[model samples]
Target: MELKDRLLTIAKEIPPGSYPVDVGTDHGYLPAYLVKQGIVSRALASDIGEGPLLAAKQHIEALSLSDRIELCLCDGLTGIDLSDKTHIVIAGMGGETISEILLRRHPLTQTLLLQPMTKVETLRRFLLKHGYRIEKEIPAYEEKKAYTVMLARYDGIVREGDDFFWTFGALPQSKKKEKYLYFQSLLSRLEKKQKGLQKAQTQERTELDRLAILIAKAKEYLQEELYDHHSGNL
Candidate 1:
């Protein structure tokens, strides 16, 4: 089975000649792809539940990749063991969940590929508060959903001071129409909710304010050259 563009990007980040572990691998697709492409010599496919574990096993068997890929039934790195040669991928989860997993499994590995389904800011903040350095972030929209997958490494001290770092990673500010229009559309939607809604409440107000700030900052980044897309470089 072919992987999505976002998943492929995460897979490609595993370096040219290295082994990687796919955490929360739903169907063992990524490890299989990497092994077949000769990008990685081996992979450990892990999932939290048995349903996905069965699916992964079936896929691996179909592809005859049992030797190249190992399947494990684990919960958020509960029993994960990573050597110095392991690159980890954790997706299909919230940012907080990803952060928790890493917090428990820190000393085992430093290289991490993270994709959070929601609460990404919380994840980014948690990483900074801890000792993780977000090296790279790639944004992609697939299946009508926008996903930001990040590559992070271990550090001893926390990095700080960027307020909008979670929303826009080092992707060059593009006033080139699509990005500006998307931000505008998002702003419009948020405004519509805040304007004449019959069920206006405190939670909605709080969320509306947050979205508004994100929209304004996005505009600022687009209007200026202050876009910070990566963690390592500027």
Candidate 2:
């Protein structure tokens, strides 16, 4: 089972020998890939809906990974037991949903690989507030759309900040081309929003000012990264 770039990016973040439980395992390709490649001895794949779970079952069976990858029908992690798993992948979902799943009474001690389709800022904030630390972020491009795969671990440390770090990301990303382009794309979006709300109310104006500052700061960071790359300082 070949995975797309986005899914592959998420899969690569899962450590070897990890017992990964893929939340919302749409097609189960990730777990199948991991098992087939001998990256992990076993995994648990779960989906909220019957349709996706059925498809995942078929895909896992076709790859003959049924024994290595267990399938479960559950909402988030409600009906599944992750006591033995060390890694949890919550990808291809909205940031809000991912945050909610991590909050579902399960101990957030597992390493997490998250790929939020939207609202990455919200997801980052949630992680910071909930005592998780993002260890690394890798950017990938699929069909001209950019996606970021985040690897986080539960550290029980509540990160505090409301700056560009929260909006963009922690500094020193993997230094890939797509990573640079991802921040550029974020700058473009912030600029557009700032312009569109130029004549907004006082509260909106404050938000706009913050976006402006973030845009400038992101530009500076990218320039420094580029310079370091050229000078072999990265």
Per residue, candidate 1 scores C-alpha lDDT tens digits across 1-234 of 577867886876788777788889998889999988878878888998899999999988998889988888998777766764568888878888888888886654458888888787788888777777777676655675566777888876778837567555434243233344434444465457656442554556666676677667766765554334563222
Name the TM-score of candidate 2. 0.91
- lDDT of each residue in 1-234, candidate 2, tens digit only: 577889988887777899999999988888989999999999999999999999999998998888889999999988777689898899899999999998885458888889999989899999888888988788877888878888888888898867877777753445557777778788888888887787554467678778888988888977876446655643
> Per-prediction TM-score, please?
0.80, 0.91
Off by over 4 Å in 1: 169-213, 223-234
Q: Which candidate is the best by lDDT?
A: 2
lDDT of each: 0.73, 0.84
Instruction: Please give the clash total of every predicted structure, in order.
Output: 6, 0
lDDT of 1 at 183: 43
Q: Which stretches of candidate 2 lie over 4 Å from their true place?
A: 199-203, 227-234
Give the per-residue Cα lDDT of candidate 2 at 18.
Answer: 90
lDDT of 1 at 79: 71
